[model samples]
Target: MLTILLTAIVIINLLFIYTLVKDLIKHKDEVMSEPASTIWTPIAQVIIYFLSTFGISDFAISTALYPKAKWVSMKKLPGTLNTQCVIPVFVMALAYINSISVGVTTLLVCIVCQVIGAYVGPYFVVKLPEKVIKNFVVVGLLVASLLILAGKFNWIPANGTATELTGTKLVLTGLLMFVYGALNNIGIGSYALTMATVYAMGMNPAAAFPIMMGACTFSVSIGSMQFIKLQDYSRKITMMSVFGVIGVLIAVFLVKSLNTQMLQWVVLVVLLYSAVSLFMAGRKESEA
Candidate 1:
């Protein structure tokens, strides 16, 4: 039953992508003014959407496979859906912060501190300095790289969410996730960070997958809708969405399972490349 539902979702997503791509191509002449648009943007968006839906659906299916935990309430979908909209906004902010932060660790701390300061600390402290922000991003990237390397080398145990959360570690983990949720405004991806935190906490890695996907989907849907409303939609984004949908369907339905270690290595390599790109971009900006 689960497999059938998942397959249906995949098929729907593929069809959605096909429609989007066909429309874009058909209207290419009218949309050609924005030559900067890539042929893949619509496709990517589609994949992101599909994957998000798939992830959420998979979680729901899996949860049904076992007896429901007392603490888990299926009724939280509405609230969860509402919260998802905030992810993209947070991601956008994180991305901007990372670009300017001087150290990646500082950036990570800043992310955590900013969230805390916003809710609990002095409002004045919430507004971090430009230099401080820059430093933090640089440090955060370094830390992320270290984490990727560690995971890749199997130096760290990659467990799932079968462990109970307790004590200081649990509290800290919760705080980090809240901060991560907030930082999604700047375009900092919460997926990798969430995965790392969950893994570090000795939780089931698979459990984190659904949570991250849910959050990402909710945020992106809201943000994308806003973009669309503001007339920010373009052929590039459209193309990416289409391809993204295709990718998601393939990933979720056809490739239901993957080698975690291999996936980790691929993700690590991608992050390393991204870090290098950011560093180089910063260098060029400084040189200019």
Candidate 2:
């Protein structure tokens, strides 16, 4: 079931890319000057590399690491996590907003506003200073560290199953999904995080794959279309989409398995590096 679903996903993505590229080429003169124009080829290649090297490998590793994982029919994580979907929803929104923003300080302010708005309504949130953003990045590292530690200690279940859901779980799960759908606007990837949350709550990781992928596909399709219509498309972004599709396909077929622990370690390290890079970028911008 998992294999078939993944294959379908790959095929659908390929078709989407083909159509996008065809449209771009057909309207080349009209779209050439977009902000993401310079990045199309490189983004496509990167996506290819990402899927081939990371995405597929990660999924395989996840399955191997939790072979006994069962399906989760529930709408959300079993307990508190389901009710608290707002937390992740908010975090994801901040992540997406930060991804598209131009300046580090602006990103920092956006993050602050997001965090605060999640708890309270949008108020007089001031622009975050460079130092604050750097601090926030460091804080993110700490949070990631805690999650890793929690997983290692078996303090929390690393995956979930469908059988765990009850009536209440179903209702809450539906609500969480709605929240995730809305949060997709900011560019946050609800897929992995949703999988992780469900897995932690005791659902089958494999089952979570389809749900997350479906949600992401729907959200990204709309988001990408908006970008296309707004002439917000760029070569880099388009290329990323193309290569990302290719990379995911190769990863699904060529990489038969992966080491989950090792992959997690690598992801953690990359995240840390990304944080530092963001900090440095913020600092440089402030100096300039």
Candidate 3:
């Protein structure tokens, strides 16, 4: 079952990549304003996912892609990058469905809450000040990344063996997912934050992959449509969807072959990169 599921992941990724490449080539001469973001942003997102299941395409955009995508304004970048994520995040969620099945009730609760947040989030994204959004994103990612890193090394009591949450834990998780879902619109990636929530609550770290990916799949898919309706998105760098899939496949294999110690450091570096990058961006914007 695991093998088949994982293989399905590979196949779905390939299909997304094929479609993305076709779209990119077809429109490269027209809408392709910044080629660098097209090339590196996807790659950076996968690297972060590889090390820490952050699964955030926007982190790549803010840190790598946005710097180069000059034609895309900061206000529109969140929505624009999110549209590129819909398919890739869906593909990633499928990769973890089986693992999260043990916690079906928990998953359903999260999805319900996330849907509510995802539906309403774009409106806030439009109205909220950019500095406020950046601050929220920076603090959330920074704290979550640090917690996960501490947990990774036994610097904290973490990496719980529980596969699912019950009672208060489950209800709290739903609430957290709701907040994370809304934050997703303003440039916060929910994957790492969700992982931190579950890990702290005693769920297995491995299980975090499926749960976070699955929840965000629904949230992002629903939320991105509002971004489109609001005309806050850009289509030029959507090709990153394909490259992200490729990065996932590579990361999967490398993860399988690498030693645990080496993987730990990789995760640490990427998590810090994500946190620090957001912090710096927030500070830069606030200063201006």
Candidate 4:
């Protein structure tokens, strides 16, 4: 069953990759008009690499790119989000493949729920008010990042050796992942939330990695289609996706010896700033 599931996810992800590549080629001429993207893309990818080294996951890139998209076009935010996720999803699936065996049933539940939510998410996000989407991203970033900081400081209790969840805990985790999947459409990431949820439910924190990765892999790939069909994303964001992979490679191979604690601290600081910047941007939308 595990092998079958892995096979399915790999095939699906490949198909999504093909779709994104085709779009990239078809729209290669459509360079983003916003000059700011040229400056922000490299900066954001650097931040993503730093955060990923600390095990922050693809949510880091989503948070980084969403604001950049907002600067260019509010309508493209969702599409930019879906596009940005492709590289991280592929990288994570390969990196975390072994961890999936720890909680196969729970992982399956999350993937199913999140995939459904992801499929329907783009429709709602595109219609949402600019203020609403921006506010959602701000709140999501604040909540998720703060939770991680809180966990580090031992402000939140989460100590469990269990590898899997059962019964009511399983149901609750599924529901939360579904919400996270929907939120992902608006450029909100599920990594911290999924980590928090599974940890609180007494599952091993290690298990959360694979569960979150697998869920996101299926959900984002399925969700990107909606954004593509709507033509609601910026075409130029694809270039940054290449840089994102490079960031991950450097972090994993070149800088693996860096201080993990310091990296986490730096990422938390960036996430907080991102939250504030997004809040300010949201206000600007309201004023405009």
Candidate models: Cα lDDT each: 0.42, 0.39, 0.64, 0.74
Candidate 2: which stretches are off by over 4 Å?
Answer: 1-27, 30-155, 163-166, 283-288
Give the lowest summed-lDDT range of ten residues in model 1: 58-67
Scanning candidate 4 in windows of ten residues, the lowest lDDT window is 49-58
Report the Cα lDDT for residue 143, model 3: 58
lDDT of 4 by residue, 68-185 (tens): 5555465566667666667666666656765345677888899999999999999888898877776776777787678778878877557778877789998998899899899889
Alpha-carbon RMSD to native, per candidate: 15.0, 14.6, 5.3, 2.8
- Show pairs that collide, candidate 4: none
Q: What TM-score goes with each of the models?
A: 0.51, 0.54, 0.73, 0.86
Rank by lDDT, descending?
4, 3, 1, 2
lDDT of 3 by residue, 1-288 (tens): 445534544554455446555655665675566533656666665654444333433343343345344646666767765666766566567656753454667767777788689889999888877667556656655655565466566765455888778999998989999998887887766766776687778887777778777677677767877776675666564545555666555655445544446554554565567657767867787799
For model 2, residues 4-72, the per-residue Cα lDDT tens digits are 433544554455456567767878775545333344434434432343233222222221211122211
Assess candidate 2 and give its TM-score to the true structure. 0.54
Candidate 4 residue runs with Cα over 4 Å from true position: 32-50, 57-71, 99-101, 250-258, 284-288
Which residue runs of candidate 3 sit more than 4 Å off their true CA positions?
A: 1-30, 34-65, 68-71, 99-101, 152-156, 253-288
Q: Which prediction has more favorable lDDT, 2 or 3?
A: 3
Positional deviation of 257 in candidate 3, in angstroms? 5.4
| Top candidate by TM-score | 4
Instruction: Decide which is better by TM-score, 3 or 4.
Output: 4
